[model samples]
Target: MTNNQRTEAVYIHIPFCTNKCFYCDFNSYVLKDQPVMDYLRALDHEMELTVKAHPPGAIKSIFVGGGTPTVLKPDEMEYFLHSVKRHFPVWSDDIEFSMEANPGTTDLEKLKVMREGGVNRISFGVQAFQNSLLSGIGRIHDTDDVYRSLDNARAAGFDNMSIDLMFGLPNQTLEMLAESVDKALELRLPHYSIYSLKVEENTLFHTMYQKNQLPLPDEEDELNMYLLLMERMKAAGYKQYEISNFAKPGYESRHNMTYWRNEDYYGLGAGAHGYINRQRHVNIKGVNPYNEAARTGLPRLESFEVSREEAMEDFLMVGLRVLDGISRTRFEQQFDASLDEVFKRPLSKMVSAGLLETTEDGYRLSSKGILFGNEVFAEFIGTLSAN
Candidate 1:
């Protein structure tokens, strides 16, 4: 088979967590029973096979995401980093190497090891500031640990730092959300990813929601919180580049932008997803399954060829999630079809309904559209031939 001739991004998933958060649906397990060394070996074997076949280089970004990446010891971090450096073959200057950490699990030594190991960006998951809300969501860290971790990161010479915060939790209110944003802005980090709580099925939050025991803010309250956050973040001079992420100028996450821009990224680790050269595939889900497969070959993949029509819809859907909206030029360039020709029907309907507006080179969701984003996205689904 011919190799795909496309520049790609890399995502390395570390699936070991100190403990599971009630709201998390990610493929992470409690570390007690996990085979850490064996997992690493499996991951290394996968890397060897991938690099030998594809020889990935000119990499734009590498995001080491989690089940809490900081759960790995500093030395363990070194082993992984070294593997990445050897296999990916990145230039020293342009690459963005980002790692996600839970606030309580990081320390100065760990941060130092990571920074020196070539991790230029650090994103901490500091979900909420209030201890009451933190415990309510089953987060392992308190507010103090958040600040402490930040201090440790700064001391380790990480200038480009981002913190992930969440609002609209169980029993959370607009006022509380405002305070969370207020607290976050005070830190003056380069980037902040503030997301609303999403309770997915099979999680503890979902179970509570079914029993009517989940103390969630009502719909109106959630909308109020969302609007308030936009105002505050705008006033604070952070650009809402995406629905849930805000960053200072030039500090936007290049790694994540690859996803929002609907570009290819190699997703490594158990339960990771990838869209490489227009084919979408998922890695095996469980840790042991992934490990066993990688030592042999990647297993349990559900792979599909992305048809040209499906690609256009996908580009519109994921790219629209970026606050800047979808690029008509880019859609045409990628799929060899004009955006208008492909999405004329939904585009017209959405525009008439005041959901999307035409920009110079593309279209962006209007105020009403963002509020009802899912509804807007659904219009572009099914088939573009209806246009």
Candidate 2:
């Protein structure tokens, strides 16, 4: 069995945005006429109840995500950050405090507020570097906003920064993606997360797709886009640490590593999901409902315990996403069982099929496996029984 230890990571959510993007299905509402302060107070209460129940360790990482966290007014941001420190008082000396921002939202004063509040890293949602693509995707900001925001972030004393880019966008071509990549690399940020667009349910993209209005790249074109990005990022000296994420050495996202490693973290605020002591819980999704629910207790929409078999499967599904792959010693430490013994069947089959290669530490996806990652991950799900 895994040893008992307090969680060392925290994730806070801010569910307000200036406007919802066409492709985004995240739990966020437009910022007009919303009870911003009331929501912050509710989040503060949630943090209080959480720490009292589980008692956090010296927090090694804190990531404040949102529809657009930088959209918060400076006063509201200050209040929220102060509350975070008050509840989880102890922090590691080198704690990674990250906040997600969007172009056109993070002005110099707002960013300085964030830095003063202990946010040391910023991830901007600069989906593409083209003005037409930005407008087509329902983004309010253009390429100019991207450059100006990066400049402001730097002026506000932020050097450790990252930006997101998208591939397989509607009406996007191989040439378009290449141009976006060139502009992104020009910024020379420490980290980059480039993802292929997925048409998830309840988003405008899904509606358009069903009506045959969305003109997304074809499958072959999408595959080429992924391959092109991998080669370019490698040539530019960025390591493809995960399938879609590339970073300079030691600049990987530590907060995300907690989830990939299947560790516990405190998830607070509306629409946030938290896993602690083997139990997972998702807070209420709606803003007013969440505010009301946190008044008395934990605002959990649903809570459940993760079974050992499921946890083991998850260990493979997420751990293998890292380029270095899961560690054998780490697996043994968590499950008190040998990695080879527990997953002998799937391990042997995958190795035989040439999708997974054995490492000195454990198992990782081969080059071919990276292209067909979904099939490899699907192999492990529901394959284990609760013995």
Candidate 3:
């Protein structure tokens, strides 16, 4: 593929995990007996071919997300990072290089290699502070492991760190969530991402839900959990930059913002998805198939151009996720039609219903709309079908 637009962000997916979580529907597999090295080499090859085809503008962000990137041994991590540096040689001076880690998987040696290899930020998957809750979710790490891992990460020269927490867990209570929040705030890390557990298809949680065996929190309790967390985060002085993410000033996740802003990015590795040159491409998902295909060429399972209408819908859906909302000028510039002209009906309806508040520059979710974001987003869908 030829392109004049310079891609500035890259997302690398690692498909191997120590163990799959009960609720995770992500494309990840358990790491035992897997062709780990071969997959890395294939990923290297994919990056080589991709950069050559699309080239790049000084990449501003690189996110290594996974089944668990830290699961790679020190030498393996070194080799993997070497391949990354070799392929995407040019990076901005302040490039946000981030890697996702599982608490139990990281050690001093591995973290040292990761830091020295250009990983400036580490996000640990510390789902909760309670040991029972941790095991209930199939996570190996307990509260103690969370502390040890953070200490090791800091010792390895990583001060830019973040931890992920989850609420509305099985058998979780309001008091338990409050304790988790208190512990997370006590860490005083630069960023924190707390999400509610969604029972997705093909996961253990889904099966349990089908059998009416999952002990999930009721709607009222879940809503209270969200409200409580937001209140706590604000009181603690972290900006609610995104619905699920909070950060100190200048510490928001630039890589994730790239997606919420509906910009193009290169997705590499098995089961990765990329949006470039107006088309979206998904790579072959299975590890073996991806490795084989990468040896020859792009391991793409599908690549299709995104329709203009579809792009507009995506712009509204994702842009609203950010606290800043969608820019009317940007929408007009991108589509060459006024945002009002394009989404007049939904815009009017949402505003009248107090779900959206119009600003001089754009439209954003009203305070009430933030709580009912899905409903607001749904209004934008299919509005262009009549056009």
Name the runs in model 1 displaced over 4 angstroms. Answer: 1-4, 385-387
lDDT (tens digit, per residue) of candidate 1 on 236-284: 9999998888999999999989988888888888888877777788889
Estimated TM-score for each candidate:
0.97, 0.98, 0.98
Report, for all candidates in order, the number of backbone clashes: 1, 0, 0
Give candidate 2's error at residue 230 in angstroms: 0.6
Name model 3 segments beyond 4 Å from true. 1-3, 385-387
Evaluate model 3: give its TM-score. 0.98
Candidate 2 structure quality by residue, lDDT tens digits, 1-387: 244688899999999999999999999999999999999999999999998898888999999998899989999999999999999989999999999999999999999999999999999999898899999999999988999999999999999999999999999999999999998999899999999999999999999999999999999999999999999999999999998899999999999999989998999999999988788899999999999999989999999998888988999999999888889999998988898998999889988988899999999999988988888888888888544
User: For candidate 3, lDDT tens digit of each residue in 1-387?
Assistant: 125668999999999999999999998989999899999999999999998988888999999997898999999999999999998889999999999999989999999999999999999999899999999999988999999999999999999999999999999999999999999999999999999999999999999999999999999999999999999999999999888999999999999999988888999998999988778999999999999999999999999998889889889999999988899888876778788888888999999999999888889999899889999999888777446
Q: Candidate 1: worst 10 consecutive residues by lDDT?
A: 1-10
Candidate order, lDDT descending? 2, 3, 1
RMSD of each predicted structure: 1.8, 1.1, 1.4
Summing lDDT over every window of 10 consecutive residues in candidate 2, give the lowest-scoring window: 1-10
